[model samples]
Target: MNPNLLTPPRRHGERPTTTGLEIPHDQLDMFSPPRVRAELVKQAQALPGVFTGPSQVSEPSSLALRLRQPLGPWEAFLHPSTDEFGHIHRAGFLHLTLPRPLLAPLVEAGWAEQHPISLRPEWPDTIVMLYAPRDDGELDVVLAALRASWQQASTEKGR
Candidate 1:
């Protein structure tokens, strides 16, 4: 991990806008614009194995996206399953941007388990559900999507 790249910004009174996932000790310090942007790009581009290492199906989703590999599994579930070893979520990209500067803490909290961070970008904002997958394969399609989205985001941000 790149220390300079991943380190959170230091702001004395800065506080994380509380989300539903706030842990007792998990405090999101200040996040820089560049850092946040990079994370948005990196997290989307990161290989699944680097973060989670291996793949397993503990509780597969029942909603079109199931347990197995990438795209194929997505066509399997209709109802979210408890044993599905993937990330199942609704709309939530905005929440994801909040953690852009805190990669280490997010990983430690099991945010990137095995599900791709599902996204629904809206006008001026994107709603995404970061279904963290433990395996690299799970991120395949997501990464591709991210690449496409990133291109647009970068263009919009003037990268």
Candidate 2:
């Protein structure tokens, strides 16, 4: 994929506040309302090669997005214990894997940040916590990021 294509425009306003290293990592502001959050889950589950399930690495209430047939590198997963490419928190933020090239750009653009666990040597640095979509426009961008993750998981590309 073209790096430019994955580079979304800088998100407007300041980055939403988050509980950076907390176990229940969460975005405290710029929330995706219940309706938008539901829609995001609905649309993300509809993405090709994906299915919704209880997260293998998150709270039981969190929704995990898994690839039915993964062909990409291990970096496509939030953890090696599962094929999950992403999972939406009850608070609406998401933890997903992105291609290495897309990582810094997304973070710099203020759409996401590296997952706290990702700082560990055992974890893939590709893991990131995508901020919640506060509205339709942001939802589109979040979905695009999810699609990028789906594409990465459905291909054989290396990190």
Candidate 3:
């Protein structure tokens, strides 16, 4: 990750608004689903800026990352929001979302952070959550890997 991409110091009340972004939640896959999910939870606990920790919601368990660099609570949450497509042929597939303000900083961090990932401008400022699985030549693995990576990446970045 590019260290310079970090958010610059902000003034007393300056907050960034959403410009545009491409977040891919349907293209992530992994080698092993359950194992990867476990690793994700472990990593989330180990990483910083992970509040409420990674756990199972009404659905599957997920890790969430929130940021508050420039305002009272400029936050973004990343967690498993949907299930695998049940059919696909790739790993590293996932569904993820973030606040519009976070787009610039995240993309500036690296190119892999940006790609075929889609967006929903219809929603409010908050990004809806999604999930992706790993591409172990199967759908389950892809979902597992995607979920784990999402949690791990958020934990890693927040640190």
Candidate 4:
């Protein structure tokens, strides 16, 4: 991992903000600027066995990560995709995978939201539950969640 994770100048360290919630250990901006989003893509690329490319999802365009091998059944590793118009978000959200233990705490803590189930019902349970990062002050938490997914999909797999 990069020691100096090139984050936006929101703040550094685990400091408490107006909301009384300690922001992610890493600093982040209030929103996803192009540079900030590019940094996210860069981090995902640095992971082992991760290859960045167009999403496997049927869309006009989007970014996604593919593992060198399948994690059980899914090939996609992470989902911080961009839209066809080159917008980082069609809206202003991104999806990521997290283990149940991680997911529950993050949900209760208000760091993430469960992905829309109607989007893809065929996904396995391991992947069925996804989370969208909050742009408020949780990009780092979101990035950390994505990193965990990469670790599970790449290193933790039966490689």
Instruction: Return the top candidate by lDDT.
Output: 2
TM-score per prediction, in order, is 0.24, 0.90, 0.30, 0.57
lDDT of 1: 0.28
Stretches of candidate 2 exceeding 4 Å from the true structure: 1-6, 157-159
The models' CA-based lDDT, in order, is 0.28, 0.85, 0.31, 0.43
Clash count per candidate:
34, 0, 34, 0
Regions of candidate 4 where Cα sits further than 4 Å from its true position: 1-31, 71-92, 118-121, 126-137, 156-159
**RMSD of candidate 4 to true structure, Å:** 9.4
- The candidate scoring highest on TM-score is 2
- The digit string of per-residue lDDT tens for model 3 on 1-159 reads 112213522222222222225332332222226645454445433434333323232223333332212121122232232211111112312233443445455344321133232333433233332223222223332233333333433443345
- Candidate 2 per-residue lDDT over residues 18-55, each given as its tens digit: 88987667778888899999999998988888888899
- How do the residues 1-159 of candidate 1 rate in per-residue lDDT, one tens digit apiece? 222213322222323332433221112332334434334445643533222212132222111122222221221221123112222221212222222333343333433211232221221122233332223432433343333323332232222
- Summarize candidate 4's per-residue lDDT along 57-115 as a digit string, tens digits: 42324456666654522423333322111112322234445554565555455454444
Error of 2 at 13 (Å): 1.6
Which scores greater on TM-score, model 1 or model 3?
3
Please give the ranking of all candidate structures by lDDT, highest first, separated by commas: 2, 4, 3, 1
Off by over 4 Å in 3: 1-32, 49-97, 101-124, 135-159
**Ten contiguous residues minimizing lDDT sum, candidate 2:** 1-10
Clashing pairs in 2: none
Q: Which candidate would rank higher by TM-score, 1 or 2? A: 2
